[model samples]
Target: MSGQLFVIGLGPGNASQVTPEASHAVAEAEFFFGYGPYVDRLELRPDQTRIASDNREELSRANAALQRAAEGAKVAVVSGGDPGVFAMAAAVCEAIEKGPVEWRDIDLTIIPGVTAMLAVAARIGAPLGHDFCTISLSDNLKPWAVIERRLEAAASAGFVIALYNPISKARPWQLGSAFEILRRHLPGDTPVIFGRAAGRPDERIEIVKLEQADPAKADMATCVMIGSPETSIVERAHKPPLVYTPRFSTESSQ
Candidate 1:
């Protein structure tokens, strides 16, 4: 019999953010496969085998997990955030669809966790209270033109935008390029949030205007949230400002 495969999201690299269901899934696994950092984060049992790979090997990692599961090994494939969001879940799905026919019968479960954008949003207030869209700024998978078109479309649609994989060593200028496109459709003073290492010890949150967003401050660990025109910021005397996008486009009468 084929063993089960669980694609678990280890939310924002914090113990508290991981769901109990995800914990249980981990406990049940005899083998774990994931990016090296995420694999290192787990408290592995003595009997569990750890399959760690460097970044950008998502497809290979997913195949490894699936093959082991097919061999009757209870396996867990870990992703940094909710696996469905630009993580292992999609890769696993695609692999199953394209791989050997028997792979389809293998039991699979995806355990969700707190995605980075949601964790960052909570820390900054309710910037995602209304309609929102997420986009990855990495051009490694798709063409830069596609990203620009999506940015323009999201800006024109006035959706709260949460950007993932905003900047990295190899693609440092994408964030700045994104801001340039967005500013054409969004106001110069629109609220932009930079949440770095959101739930970890070195977490940092910065609020800035669209025109003032410095791409230099961003890295791969950061998630950038850009508020819609209706988004509001509330200042407090002794606390960080609260940023939120309202549920309604305009005020409603009582």
Candidate 2:
């Protein structure tokens, strides 16, 4: 008898942000498999076993978790933020598609949690209140040219853009290049938000203009939001400004 497998998202580095559904899944799982830091977020009981690997070993981790589940172990594959959003949920799905026939037969459940972009948006205001799209700035899985094209297209189309994996040691130049691409289509005064470790104790949220947006301000933990032309900032006395995109668009009036 094959056991169950749960793909769970832990939310954006905050215990409070983790959904009840995800907590239930975590409690039910006997074995957990995930990247090192994400697995570290779990406060597992003595009976629960954790198997951690490097961040880049997603496929191998998924296969190992599936194998355990096939052998009747209640397994959980974990990711930070939403599992489906550029995370381990897709990795597990990819493994299932190309993995053994039995792997597909294993009972699977995906538990959702708050992603980074949502957390970041909440910290400031609703930049994602209007039509928007997310793009990963990392070029490991796809070409940099494709990223550039998407950035340009999204900007030109007036979509509020949320950029994940904005910077890393290996790909230091990608975020700068992404900013350059957006500049061609967006005005120099467009508001750009750099939200780092949002909802965590060490959280930092900064807003800047598109022309002055510094890529060096970001790390892998940051979620950068580039506002559309319609996005606005409302200033308050002695308080941080609220950044948002109006629900109504001027283009719609035409």
Please, what are the lDDT tens digits per residue for candidate 2 over residues 116-159? Answer: 99999999989998999999998889988899889989999999
Runs in model 2 with CA error above 4 Å?
252-254
Local distance difference test, per candidate? 0.93, 0.96
Candidate 2's TM-score: 0.98
State how far residue 10 of model 1 sits from its true place (Å): 0.7
lDDT of 2 at 199: 97
Predicted candidate 1 versus true structure: per-residue lDDT over 5-98, tens digit per residue: 9999999998999999999999999999999999999998899899999889988888888999999989999999899999999999988998
Model 2 RMSD to the real structure?
1.0
Residue pairs clashing, model 1:
none
**Clash number by candidate, in order:** 0, 0
Instruction: Tell me the lDDT of model 1 at 21.
Output: 97
**Alpha-carbon TM-score of each model against the true structure:** 0.97, 0.98
Cα deviation in Å at residue 215, candidate 2? 0.5
